[model samples]
Target chain A: PSETHRNAAEARQNTLTKPPGSLGALERIAIQLAALQETERPCADNVQIVLFAGDHGVTAQGISAFPSAVTVEMLRNFASGGAAISVLARKLDARLEVVDAGTLATSEVAGVVTDKPCHGTRDFATTPAMTPDETAFAFDTGRRAVARTVDRGAHLLIFGEMGIGNTTSAAAVAAALLGKAANDLVGAGTGLDSDGIRHKARVIDAALDLHGLKAPDVPAADVLMKVGGLEIAALAGAIVAAAQSRIPVLVDGFIVTAAALAATRLNPSCADWLIYSHRSSEQGHRLILEALDAEPLLDLKMRLGEGSGAAVALSVVRLACALHGEMATFAEAHVSESL
Target chain B: PSETHRNAAEARQNTLTKPPGSLGALERIAIQLAALQETERPCADNVQIVLFAGDHGVTAQGISAFPSAVTVEMLRNFASGGAAISVLARKLDARLEVVDAGTLATSEVAGVVTDKPCHGTRDFATTPAMTPDETAFAFDTGRRAVARTVDRGAHLLIFGEMGIGNTTSAAAVAAALLGKAANDLVGAGTGLDSDGIRHKARVIDAALDLHGLKAPDVPAADVLMKVGGLEIAALAGAIVAAAQSRIPVLVDGFIVTAAALAATRLNPSCADWLIYSHRSSEQGHRLILEALDAEPLLDLKMRLGEGSGAAVALSVVRLACALHGEMATFAEAHVSESL
Candidate 1:
């Protein structure tokens, strides 16, 4: 982000017809976009949603309400344009790309980029989800995916994930990073009842103990290799790459936010390029948001992942850009200003 | 709201590809729209934003950061498509109507409906802001405005207010109705510093004491006559009329919520027709939302109250309806459901 463009945008905002700072976060968003794009007229014209689909080995611990097969089923749904992200991507006129980081089902699906680090991941309850080399491979996969999108003239990047039991993986990563207990970080993924939530929490607790990562000092890559799903590690890499490339990344719900946390942990400066779309209804999302000091654009109590929250928020970001670019100044409108 | 249509919409939502209740408030909003429209295919195709512009005599109390003249200035801004709501209304293709219910500046302006009970209300510190007849007149003005929109085939009604120091009036009305202290409800209106907030709170406290109506049991009409601006009174009337006519009202930020509260107080069932657009950044809005049990669609820390929040949220509401009316069902898409 350029300070010159930010200062210029701030000046432009003050001259627009309304009380100074009356638009609130919309004004801030516009200014931030101006700084990121290094242009006075910042627009979110070219938006793309990259969905990283993988499967969590921790599903073997029975932490999720749905079976692991749902992950593969959803990837197929995404390819068929029947998933939530697909619906939203079409609504926003955004390009949708599904990257198969590593799903349990290894069959090639049309419209899905099949690139696997391994056949899913090892169950983190008894072993690391991925080896160090596999974690690096996934990171490079995500970076390459982002590079492809940016190379295709995509200015706004939205990251979503589809993986059964990935929320448990996210909870483990967050617990390790934030130094919080599993009970505090665990939530019912895909509609768990109270008993199910309790059982899920116990499973995460066991994973945390097994990994011996009940501390905040764990390195980002170490966290991913030990407990993160292949898709999450890829998402973190994409976030870092997007920031490096100066393209704004709109982050989605809880699982995606955990990836953002990992990216920020790896490259603390990457947080500047990330815009949190919405605070998910997921229990641990607020803690992650607070840890990042991220004030999301919306809070619709939406817990569905797959970058749906980010896709929904694309309208607001677009509107912020539209208003910033289209609204007339006080002088042009011939409106009186406060004395 | 038609129960049959609502039931049909709920049934349709249950059959969508996602999990039952996974869409959260979006699903509820769709069902509510279906009920209001009396059709399973709910649509926000024809939307209207009627901005009630007036001047508050309470500006004499130094309660707002900008002068009362800003009320009329903003009306011009709205007319010229320079206001936030104007840009948003244009973006959403919603009709924008500026109703000059009562402004201190009474000159006829292009694109403004110059209907005024008077130039402005009297200073509430020394006297009632409006007489019972004036309050009744304002209500009728609002009801008539809404009637015009509904007659023009507007399916969604969004009410916004443009009045300097209107927040002070709203806070007083909310404080009186909610039985809360002035300090608790008052916030920095239009960039008021801390000292300005304290002064505004003191003014509201004095106004409450002068009216001899500190009790929450005071009549809704009496509260309006005591502290409400002409636009606020008109907004309450508009809400009542919209509800009676079965048109869904997308309630805006703080001042608009206060009007909705007043309408509900007048006719408790009117709350059923209201859809909260966003939780305002204002201090009193949360209390009002709680009192009404309103779950707003968005929370973007927006404090601009020109139907901007409602216009921004119009996209979300439209998307909700679109998803409900357009998304393929589980059977139609051949997607599997959870066990």
Candidate 2:
């Protein structure tokens, strides 16, 4: 980010027709984008949404509400333009890329990129989710996804995921990286009752104990091998790669945020490029957000994931840039200044 | 609002591919719009923003940070597409109508409706803000403005205000209607120092006492005649007219919300059509919002009026409608539902 450009943007915001600080967060967002984009006029006119899908082996323990096969079905929905992200991508006019990171499907779904790292993970309840090679392959998958968006001239990027029991996987990864107890970080994956949630917590705790990762400063790759879903690792890799390429990443709700947590741990310098989009109603998102020191732009209580929260917030970011770049200055408007 | 349509919308929401209640406020907003529009699908595609500009005699008491001349200058700015509302209206593709509700300017400006109600209100600090006839005329202006938008097939309405010292007028009116102390309602309008705010509060308290209107259930027209700016009264009138015409009103910051409070008092039915858009940074707006039982959609700490907050939030409403109407249902997508 360019400090000189940021200072210049801040100076320009003060000259807009409104009062000094009346625009509040909108002005702050514009200045930050100006610095990150290194331009007098920042733009979010071109956005790319990358969605990675996989089946979670932990669903064998009944941690999620839906069948694991729904992961592959949602990939079909994404291709047929029926899923939430599909509708949002059209509304935002953003590029939508659906990747089958590691699903159990025998054949490819049309319009979805089929580059599987592994069919699925081993149930973390008794074994590591993936081998070290599979984890590395997932990371490469995510980096390649970022390269695709950047080469297509995407001004902004949003990472989404689809897996039936992925939230349990995300909670376990976050618990290990943040050094928090599994019970404190577990939540309803889709629509779990109190009993289901408690059971999920126990499974996570036992897995962390078996993996010996219930401590701070755990290696991100090691944690991914032990508990992270393939799509989750890919999401984290895409975040880090987008940051390295200077395309701002709008981090989504619970599942995506857990990926953001691991991404920050892997490459701390990329932290500046991630803009938290919304706080979810999920149980463990608040602690993870606090761990990342992130303040998301919206809190509509949305927890649908599939990048819906970030997609909803992208409109606000676009408006902020529009107001910053288009509104006339006080001198141009010839309006009297404050007394 | 049609209960049949609302129930149908709710039923449709449950059948969507995501988990129940995961979409949160977006789902609620869509259902409400469906009920209001009396259709299975709702929209906010055609929007009209009515910007009311006027002058306040209370500037004589040093209650505001900007010169009263700014009221007229901003009218020119709005006409020339230099004001915040002007930029936002273009971005939202909404119609922008600049109404010179009442100002001290003697001549008409191009592209502004110079329908002077009373050539601005008298100084409310030591005198009644307007005669009863002038208040009535302002309300008629607001009604006619709404009629024009309704004729233009507008699905939504937004009311904004530009008056240098109108916040003082708004605080005084809100204090009268809500039976609150003037000192509690007064805020730093435009940008005031500590000493200036204290003095403004004192003046408001004195004026409320002199009029014997520091009590609940004060007639809204009487309050307008005693302490309201012409633009404030116009905003209230527009709210009532929009509701009567079956057009949803998206209320803006402090001054507009104060107008909404008075509008609900005048015609309680209008309260059902008002959608609180964003919480402002102004002090009194929170209390007024609470009084109206409003949970605004956004809280970006924005205090810039001219309907900027509501305009920024318009896209969210549009997206909500699009999601509600376009996304594939579980049966249509052939996706499994939650167990």
- Interface Cα RMSD of candidate 2: 0.9
Best by lDDT: 2
Docking class of 1: medium
Per-residue lDDT tens digits of candidate 2, residues B1-339? 999999999999898888888888899889988988898889999999999988988889988888988888889999999888898899889999999999887899899987767788899889999998899999888998998888798888999999989989999999999999887788778889889989999999999988878776789999998999899988988999999999998889999999999999999999999888899999999999999999898888898899999998898999889889988999999998887
Q: What does candidate 2's lDDT look like per residue over A283-326, in tens digits?
A: 89999999999988888888788999999999999989988999
What does candidate 2 score on TM? 0.98
TM-score of each: 0.94, 0.98
Off by over 4 Å in 2: none
For model 1, residues B1-339, the per-residue Cα lDDT tens digits are 789999999999988777677777889899998998999989898998999988989898888778787788777788887788889988888999999998987588888998778889999988999998889999988999988887788889999989988999999999998888999999877878899899999999999999977975999999999999899999999999999888999999999999999999999999989998998888889999999999899887888788888888998987787778767777766656664
What shift in Å separates residue B308 of candidate 1 from its native position after superposition? 1.5
Candidate 1 Cα misplacement greater than 4 A, ranges: A212-216
How good is the docking of model 1, as DockQ?
Answer: 0.53
Candidate 1 chain B, run of 10 with poorest lDDT: B330-339
Best by DockQ: 2
